[model samples]
Target: MVDRGPAPRRGRPPVSDEQRRRQRLAISRHAVRLFSEQGLAATSGEQIARASGVSERTLWRHFPHKESCVEPLLTKTIDAFRTVLHAWPPDVDLAEHLRSAYQPVLNSPSATDVEAVLAVIRLTHDEPALRAAYLVLRERAEDTLAEVLSARTGVPSDALPVRVEAAAMNAALKVATDDLIHETAESGITPDALLRHREHLADAISFVTRRAPGDGRD
Candidate 1:
């Protein structure tokens, strides 16, 4: 009788969700670099898979379409910010909390991931498909913001005030993010410059939410 070593364990070892997410993110970083350099129309899924050191099957498993490849990296930034918002302490003001939490958020996404995100953002200007994906992600982020803000402010997530505030805050954040990405792409942002931009973003959110002192804080 010949044994085949228990059928070679049937399949690959089970990967943790975090590991799977990281794999997808790695693939996305490579895809974004190709898209930025070669243009979306010129870049192929096979090229992205090769550049990412993954099989075409693996790449397709992670993303439904080539344009969707950038979503994972772009999501890292929004996820970092959402994490900060979710951890907000009720006693502390949003601005103070953001200022204290911004550094970790800024540092959470790998430098390569950050650059990939910026590249995708820049590509959105010329690639309608990428722009559609970008906008969809932005909408999802806004929904997350609405939920977090509603919890923080004791308002219903569906309330008009909560939705409006969340939308306005999201718009302000998007603008700030675009400006920073543009500047960083051109000249690269120093640590000091990045911190300043963080402060500006926090201040913009504070203004949009009327969270500044004398705006209603006790």
Candidate 2:
């Protein structure tokens, strides 16, 4: 037989950034369900990893701790809100823009995904570790909000007025989301359910930004 070089070694394909993100989100979903069903203290890293079909090593590689497992979902929620805010038209009222744009974004997710998000949000209220993770993400969101608002208002992001507006806007959004999730826990997310949520957010956000009707800043 003719001499041949050793066959090229083959191993697992490289994981893309998107693939890593998806894997983290899948693990996060499993972690959220486990935490909701058994309470945070009762849910362990091993349990989350097993439920996600990953080893504890993999879970730890993705998350720093059990509580941090929920960060992906919470981050998704805050990122979506920031995206909507980024798209807010300067010539349009905040409420009006939200009325037109936010509903479709909310409705885009599957019902199961929506419920998972709501459950995670509720978990934060009772779980100190989860609450810390949530608050940290929200604080990061405030920075993003400050940037967007500063651009619109022509003020520096660190300015007192800009910082205050960002904080208030972030608080309003968080409250609106928490209220809607609790209110709709039973009904799930329906058109009417989301309408209430949309209106509450629009009103709260517009009021905080002082961009209500006749403000001209919109």
Candidate 3:
């Protein structure tokens, strides 16, 4: 099985969200460059730690293994989705809102952040372990989307249609992100691509809202 990171974080919050996010992003940056340079299996946590200016213990403190480093990279896209979803307006069409907004946000990502995201996407195909980490993250993303959709629609958590709609939205996002990663790693995931064809993703999310039993909650 792929070396997914440690067990799901079940305990009370460890550190402040900002502090942990900083450390995770720091480790993600170092690991990506190192993996791109030496190749995946050849890179070690110790080397990543040194490159990140942290200790071996600190490396594990953030990521359980070398492959797990990509978790944050994959999550960068999901995080974007999360941010947008949280801010989604009740009146606006989901697809149109995302299509109009995604590019600006993506363009705003720093060069290093973009590089790390591309590096992980390139390496994912060659590493089963990293792929597992990516999938695990995506599954968590489904729950996140579900919760947000449920809250917005006021659907009960166990409602089957809500779950199905959440699944469809999550699935659409996964495909869009995978396609973006593969293409971006080659030529680049362009603004036009996100701005123009991006409605496919929004449509996917919107479809789920329709799948719900009634008019969307919000």
Candidate 4:
């Protein structure tokens, strides 16, 4: 007769949102490294699970597809930027605020996580699957930016001008991020470089919206 294991323990405690997010990001970091070293096509969910020290079921619970493993890392930067934008003071210059907040945003992701994210982004250039994922994330970022801009400007998110500004800003940010990723991959990114990039992003938004510093005031 086959020996049965002891009765399973009753109801497991629910994972907190923060715990879930961290788990997902951790898995993503492993996935990105694998996808970068081995081609995405060659990397399997089981391999990713093994690399991340999680069960395959747990991996799928966080990411529906392999390509999506990059989402959590990508979301870290997007979420950091969103947090910075949301905290913009009405009376402060956008560029000034961005410069001041830049350090925190850059520091949001660990050095390892940042490198993983950059690797995935670099893969996007050659992998159609990863490119699709990156594009989807960018679209989501645009919507998020529109919402933030609408709140700051007292305009509807769907308003044409607001939408246009958000799109343009996102585009500029994408370029800046791509540049940063490539540059950092080669050498590394300094705090000053990140600050300058933040200033550039703020300037791009200001230029596209034709809004001067402190114009966000009611």
Scored by CA lDDT, what does every candidate get? 0.80, 0.81, 0.72, 0.79
Instruction: Output the number of the lDDT-best candidate.
Output: 2
Residue 14's lDDT within candidate 2 is 82
Candidate 3's displacement at residue 24, Å, is: 1.6
Tens-digit lDDT string for candidate 2 (125-166): 888888888888889989998888777667789998778888
Residues 107-193 of candidate 3: C-alpha lDDT, one tens digit per residue: 345445655676776677788787788778878888887787777778874688767776787788866666666556666656655
By TM-score, is 1 or 3 better?
A: 1
lDDT of 4 by residue, 1-218 (tens): 98898977789788999999889988988889899899999999999999999999999999999999999888877887778878888787766777677532334544566666678889999999999999999899999988988887788899988788778867767777776776677676676656666667767656665663236554
Lowest lDDT block of 10, candidate 1:
103-112
RMSD of 1: 3.5
Give the CA lDDT, 0 to 100, for residue 13 in model 3. 70
TM-score of each: 0.87, 0.87, 0.80, 0.85
Give the residue spans of candidate 4 off by over 4 A. Answer: 1-9, 103-109, 212-218
* Predicted structure 3: clash tally: 0
**lDDT score of residue 57 within candidate 3:** 91
What candidate 1 gets wrong by more than 4 Å, as runs, is 1-9, 103-110, 211-218
**Stretches > 4 Å off in candidate 2:** 1-10, 103-108, 151-154, 211-218
Predicted candidate 1 versus true structure: per-residue lDDT over 1-218, tens digit per residue: 87756556667898899999889978888888899888999999999999999999988988999999988888877787878877877677777778888642334544555666777888999999999999999999889988887777677888887788779878877877877776787776567657776887888887787752222465
